[model samples]
Target: MFNRLRCGSGLIQETVPRFGFGPGQENLFVHKFTFSTSKRLDRDKSLIYNSQNKPLPRLDPSVVGTGNRKRAQPVIQPSEKFNYSVRKALELIYYEEESRIPTLFPAGLKLSRYLKSRTLPLEIDLVSRAVLYNTRQSKLEKIHLQRWAPVDFDKNCAFSYLVARTPAEYAVLVTIFREISRLEPNFKPRTLFDHGSGLCTGYWAANTVFGKLTEMFCVDPSTDMNDLATNIIQQGVQNVPLPKGINFRLKAPKTISLKYDLCLSAYTLMEVKGSLERLDIVHSLWERLEEGGCMVLVEQGTNAGFQIISEARDFLLRLCEADERDGIVDNEKKGEVLAPCPHNHPCPRYHHDTVPCNFSVKYSLFDIPYFSTEDVHNDLFSYIVIKKGRREGFRFPRLVEEPLKTKNNFYCRLCTGSGMLQEVMCNKKHKDLFHLSKFLHWGDEMPVHLEYTDGKEKPRPVIDRSERSMSSGEHFRDSKKEKDFKEEKDSKEEKDSKEEKDSKEEKDSIVKNGI
Candidate 1:
């Protein structure tokens, strides 16, 4: 469902000056380097895990399609802690090297210092103004306009890029990976392909979400990026020396010839120059999918990202529909959306009044090893998950945002049944439904049935457990069982006492009468 506020705006984990430039996985901006270790930036302004107070929109019973599909998906969340020894060591090394280089090697330090001083907001404005106003959009016309490049591709820059983006990028990847794992439990891909691997965020996501990827083929045009990915991943996982199972291709092939169980293109389509050109990339990526294979496309969560996801969704659906219409696939469904959509209808966000779908999750540097500040950008992303072959499974409607609460109701924004974002409200009267809403966090599949209505969705939400997996009803049931047992035992004891008293009275009367 579209939140008007969200419709206007929102993810790049990249800080200031690191723009997505070049081709392949190079579209994701390089991560910024920082020297400070503060967890909160402007602590008073930033909310620490604001999600706690975050209000989700409501789900109206009247608007909802009815059924009890509300069976919850198994809880999938990232572990609270993971091994970060490698990162910690690297950070210390960088700090020491950074301090020594400025004094001994004066020239490079000037460039580093200048880059470090840049902020994200300032860069965005400068780039937009230059592209839109100064260049008269000429830069945009050329397809790959150079916004700005801070430094040459080198080991140090690459290391800093990956480290700086790690916290935010990991959060984004974890969410996508978790959902993918849930969607395809039986899907254990023997081979994987990563397009625009960008320090292999896809690999990290895949490894975390699904324990072992049989083999990984990572392709990115930048040699520096490929090296950085190999070094960082191997160091973190102790797979140093570039394991035989993982291959990093530093050059872009004229075409992608390899087929794999899973393929990923993360935040790279924007570099393709033209809309149709980007679609060509999408088509090529789709062609590489083996039967029953899956493809995941990701983009930054800004308006541009959402727009691209919308456009891509349209193209993929059209391709599937055309395949079906042309009888090309021998009477099988050619493709289907796996996540963030319950149905394969045209994107609801494409409509002018509707907002594009995106997912948001929070993270902090404190959660990981050797970072300057606790503050990190929240993970907001517009993504699409597609599978090659048709599957028989439940595609639950996703909760679009945090559900909103009110005095009498909760308005839940959900994307379901062909990608329609609708608001459904559940009042205090619907105890079970309302209880389920509390268990829901952002980006969850509503475990219940939701219907489409012709009426205008009521805007008023006029609305989790504290990490416990138990639902509200489960607690009630547990208490009810205890109550029922006590009542049954008390009734049995009362009956036994009455019988004993009656028998005693009868015996006494008989003895007194001397019958």
Candidate 2:
């Protein structure tokens, strides 16, 4: 969604310059542009028109999509702390090495001699061919879907997951490794906790740029990803010496108390949905890091984070537009007021301040070269690095168990013990009735409502709940009681019926012989 504000006749455009390219270079004039809340740019004021010295009609930024379109504006800014750290590191490398060199990692098990025998061409060819035959879009494609090859147990394809890895992903990982290596030269990261380490492409990137870290903790819940990571680490990897005493823990929860030297999380946090859980994850990472440890986060700028900020802004703008057009305030409009400062320290945006989540998200990015000579651009991904602050001093305001109740949000008529109506019914009475029927739509399945002790009805017995796992003792007791009850009832009924039948037969025989 895009927010279009009505400016007087013309719109304001912000132009940002590209760095590290010569004027003659086609990539030199990379445009870092973003759409304004106002109208289209003044045709006369825009740089392209000025450079060409030609009169052009007014154009809206919305019309420009790709190639010949204006670029997105930079939303993030690099702070002094971040800028200084990057600059000092670059200076140190220049003074010490006299040239930029990629950082090396600990040798686990060197398979270079074996890797040379297998060229990159061979690996890529195999990956492409296999993917062609196994892709979801291909009608003829068929997947064996076997973790282990049937023909040979020992022979495994390390490139299985890499076959599906995307180009954007590859680019992001490479960029991260390059930047981290530039920052810390001798920082041979011993413990790598790769959260959501999808496929082995990340491991491949790590191996290529940083060599073999002492022990790579490839953390991912996907069985396919885990298999691929294991295969890549154990198979014919070049120059990466597998650590003899290294530990590999997969799928299960990690209980090791050891802190990581460098933690790399790419495309991890964007998947976090719940606000509370997201904050917890960040805090957990902070706690896991050793003092002065480095954490590098790379996400799809196009898909996540501030990328969604645009959508949120557009939503608010539309809400306002609807209200103005209708001349009546919609219920939603009341909550659409923007915070005074979107990026305030301990920001109120997304309720970060009150939540246990803590991170100084700095907005910054570099101008990357596009394939065309005329176009230089910013890749949406921004790199964020935070050094763990003093643990004792880093106390956030105590997390309120629940958000403060206010009058404006307090009167939620729909949820006020009323089932989508004007009348208030005991929610407890309705809850059980609702649970008994499968006809009601509750998302993809019937809604399960447990009896609430204080709800409109008395709490149900503990055993009535379906979720309670029956213990062995309870199971035996239940079966024994049921069997005994059945046996006693059957015996009593059988005895009474038999006695009545005997008396009737005796009376019938005497009557027949009376004649």
- The list of candidate 1 runs beyond 4 A from truth reads 1-85, 88-157, 236-241, 254-257, 366-377, 451-515
Which is the leading candidate under lDDT?
1
Tens-place lDDT per residue, model 2, 1-515, is 01123389874333222122222432223222332211112211111201111111121223222322122222232223322332343343223321311111011012211211221111234446766564464333222211111111111221221221223354556555654564445455656666667654455566557776666566655564554344434442335655463444544254547677656666555455433444455545545666556555555433124332333333434544566578764443222211111111222212211111111212222121111223322233434444432111111111111111222221011111111111111222343322222121110111122122333454334353256657669989998999999999999999999999999999999999996
Q: What is the TM-score of each candidate against the true structure?
A: 0.62, 0.32
RMSD in Å for model 1 = 16.3
lDDT of 1 by residue, 1-515 (tens): 11222223542122111111222431132123321111112111111111112223334545344344343323223333333533543454445533443243334335334333322121244455665654646656333334223345475655554544444566677787777777888887777788777677777667777777878887777787775566555554433477668988864456667778887888667545456767877887788788888888887665556667777878998898898888887445489888777777876544512233677767654333333343444656788988888855876678877776555766676666655455567777867677777667778777666543333445432113235555559879977998999999999999999999999999999999996
* lDDT of candidate 2 at residue 448, scale 0 to 100: 22
**For residue 488, what is the lDDT in candidate 1?**
97
User: Model 2 TM-score?
Assistant: 0.32
Superposed model 2: Cα runs more than 4 Å off: 1-161, 164-167, 236-256, 307-380, 389-515
Worst 10 residues of 2 by lDDT: 410-419
